[model samples]
Target chain A: MIVGVMGPEGSYSEKAAKLWMQKYSMSGSELRYFADIEDAFLATVQGKSDISIIPIENSIEGSVGVTLDLLLENEAKIVGEIVVRIEHCLLSKGGPEKVRVILSHPQGLAQCRHFLKKHFPDAELRSTGSTSHAARLAGEFEEMAAIASPEAAECYGLKVLLSNIQDKKENYTRFIVLKAGKKTLTEPETGSEKCSSSACKTSLIVYLEKDRPGALYEILGTFAKRKINLTKIESRPSKKELGDYYFYIDFEGHDSDALVKDALKDIKAKTDTLKILGSYPAFKTFRSVNIDKGY
Target chain B: MIVGVMGPEGSYSEKAAKLWMQKYSMSGSELRYFADIEDAFLATVQGKSDISIIPIENSIEGSVGVTLDLLLENEAKIVGEIVVRIEHCLLSKGGPEKVRVILSHPQGLAQCRHFLKKHFPDAELRSTGSTSHAARLAGEFEEMAAIASPEAAECYGLKVLLSNIQDKKENYTRFIVLKAGKKTLTEPETGSEKCSSSACKTSLIVYLEKDRPGALYEILGTFAKRKINLTKIESRPSKKELGDYYFYIDFEGHDSDALVKDALKDIKAKTDTLKILGSYPAFKTFRSVNIDKGY
Candidate 1:
């Protein structure tokens, strides 16, 4: 099986793909890396790859808006999700004192801004395509350093100058797995049909036709009335206007659950656009192997 | 008399600051530039600057999380808001034909990704501290082109080779104006108190004590039932966990409005972290001079 990822080897996306494969007991999956998120996502959408994994959100940086945008634009269905703990390390050929240029992906650099400012304030900060790419560049110069995954040091033959260099503790990145072919969702049944998802989490996107008052509130009322616990709720711009938005929400309970089904029905009627992005298993918290429906 | 912004002279924040001053009829305010949102915001928070402007959200890129995070952490009050239209242009000392490297802030670069891929696919995309900084670099080299505001072209003696080059049309950035001092709130009067805000827009941040079922719904219900229209609603990571979030909501009523006041009373009771980021004038869309109470 071929799995597309948003970055080269040693990227968090690669780690998420590995974790996702392990959870499903699918071993020996071939990982294909792409330079950007759009390419990796489109590879899955166009069936150029069997599956793809992409970062959806980060604990510190917030939701990956482009990923959310691509998901909506491509009608991509998320089959599962894996959360990867991000422990950024400073890698270099020499010591921190000799580091004159600090390179990282924009997100990586932003995440470690406090650390960089405190230690290497004079260094010229540069943005690369991916954290791993920074590692590769750092390997070529003694004065160049990278803020990237610890695995990047190993992949690029560089020394770990400092470990866990990110400004925050317990930084986590969530990656959603997308399959090549979208499963055509049939009409949600009245709880008589068998549950398609063994997992308890469901995600959907909603876009109100107008930026009208009480439109979103009315939609949220559906979930509230059903007592569904939302795990995540985010609004990305529709790219049409400043106030226009597309909300991506994650909540507990499978779509097949009677309560969830009713909420979905009610929300769909209220919003002009409501696309069920699929349900997945709860989560595999980093380093813990335990997986359950968490009912 | 000092106004703070997140970037140098030619940045969108600078433009927003100018617009805000013009709207408030405050001429001759000094503009102080900060390197990042946190600094610009904290300048206002610390009273180092009387007022500071920071980008809150973009039509394409979505909410600036750090700005939201700082607003909540500092308990700063917003007294006004402005929206600046973003028109990224390719600027260089020379024409586009000799350009081999394209530089901008990460957001500017990301916004023009499609244009770059189609025309200058092989050109190196480098990131600088700000788009204006990229313009400065472009001024030093003929081979370097900057994707920046048109004002940057003038600031750095660069020619605009292309205009309106962002991936999407109608791009806008919403900036919230933060003031240093918090006003002491007397008990909210029941229709007896004069309205604190003349503008019809209000902004607030809420953190649910727990990700409990119906928690957020309950808050939205307060506004929905009162018919207070929400113009923008965004969720930023609480930075504690994956599912934990801080919701920022913008609505169409002054905080002094009876319905809005009641909603605030109800929402504050339900959530552990409910901060009224102050009510501000709705907005001054780019190139438009009309300002009203908007009620």
Candidate 2:
């Protein structure tokens, strides 16, 4: 199996891909690195790679807008998900005191905003394409430091000047595993499958038809009336107008469930556009398996 | 009047701040520059600056996540809004063929994504703190190109190689004017106020008490039954857990409106925390004023 991700072999997306392979009991998987996230997703969608893992949200920064945009405009369906704990470390060839320039991916720099402000207030911040790329640059420059993972520091032969430098303590990122064929996930034919209806969650993209007062309320009622709980509800611009938007929603329950199907049917009839991104097994359900076994 | 914004001047935020002042017919306003959005907002909230202008969303890139997070965490209230047409340009001191590196704010780079992919695929892309800052660097390096506004090119003394390079032609960004006062907007004492209930919009942030199935539906019902329309409804993670979220909603109606008051009363009772950002005359109302006179 081939897995494509935004990577130079040490990015968070690469780590998520490996975690996903372990959870699914899959092996002999090969990893392909791409500098751009869009390019990575495109490779998978075009069948250049069998699967793609992309980060969708971070605890501190909220939703990854570009990733959400790609999901809305693409044919990829999420087959699985993994939550990776993020711990940003400052890495450089020279000591921390010698750092005059700081290079990182924009998000990486933002995540470590407080730490950078307090310690290196005068350092010039330069943005790189990826955290791994930043580490590569840091390896060649003595006056430069990079905010990246420990793996990146190791890969580029840099020293970890400071670890766990992000602003928030409970920082985590959610990455989705996607396949190109389906618009929505359907029920499994076999009874031995782990992703049963109760353990899965559904994700959708919705756009309203007109400026009705209760249009959104009516849409929410379909899920509420059936006792379905929403996991997430985010809005993105439709690019057509200022106030207009495309709503992205993630909710509990799978397409195989009768109540979920009913809610989706009602939503499809009410909204102008309804795109089902996927129905995948919840990450918590998979994580608890090893925890329950005390491993 | 004094205005605080993310700037080195010639940045999009500075342009929006100026547009906001013009729309309000305000004079003698001086602009204060801050490297970070949070600091700009803090200066306003702390009364260091009379007002602060921050970009909230772009038509192509979606919500500015950091700004939304700040709005949720701070006590600042929205006093007005302005929409600025975004026109990105490729700037350099040298010719395009000699450009080996391109610098831009990530959003600037993203907005002009198609233009860059087709032309400068091999050029190294570097992220900067702001578009104007990118222009500053391009002025110093002959081999470097920058993606920024035309104003930035002029300010930094660089030649514009190409203009309107954004992926979409109708690219625009929305900026909100915020003040440090008011938890919720109340009716004005005099009838002379321009922001009457008819032409105003009230923005709110709501967090639910528990995971009830109909919690959000019930909250929306308050406005729907009152015939109030929602302009925008975006969700950001609460950062507490995976599925927990804080909903940001903007709807048409002023606080003085009886039906709007009714909805607010109900929403306050249904949710754990309800923060009213502000009630201000809609941007459309303000923009139409000069457009009607063909200016």
TM-scores for all candidates: the values are: 0.91, 0.94
Per-residue lDDT of model 2, residues B128-231, tens digit only = 66788889889998999999899999999999999899988888888888887665457452211357666788899999744677888898888888888888
Question: In model 1, which runs have C-alpha deviations exceeding 4 angstroms?
Answer: A186-198, A284-295, B186-198, B284-295
For model 1 the TM-score comes to 0.91
- Among these predictions, the greatest DockQ belongs to 1
Superposed Cα deviation of residue B126, candidate 1 (Å)? 3.1
Residue B291, model 1: lDDT of: 35
Writing each residue's lDDT as its tens digit, candidate 1 over A89-192 gives: 99999988899989888788878877976898667777776788789889999999999888889999999989998878878888888865443444342211
Candidate 2: TM-score of chain A is: 0.93
Name the weakest run of 10 consecutive residues (lDDT summed) in model 2 chain B.
B184-193
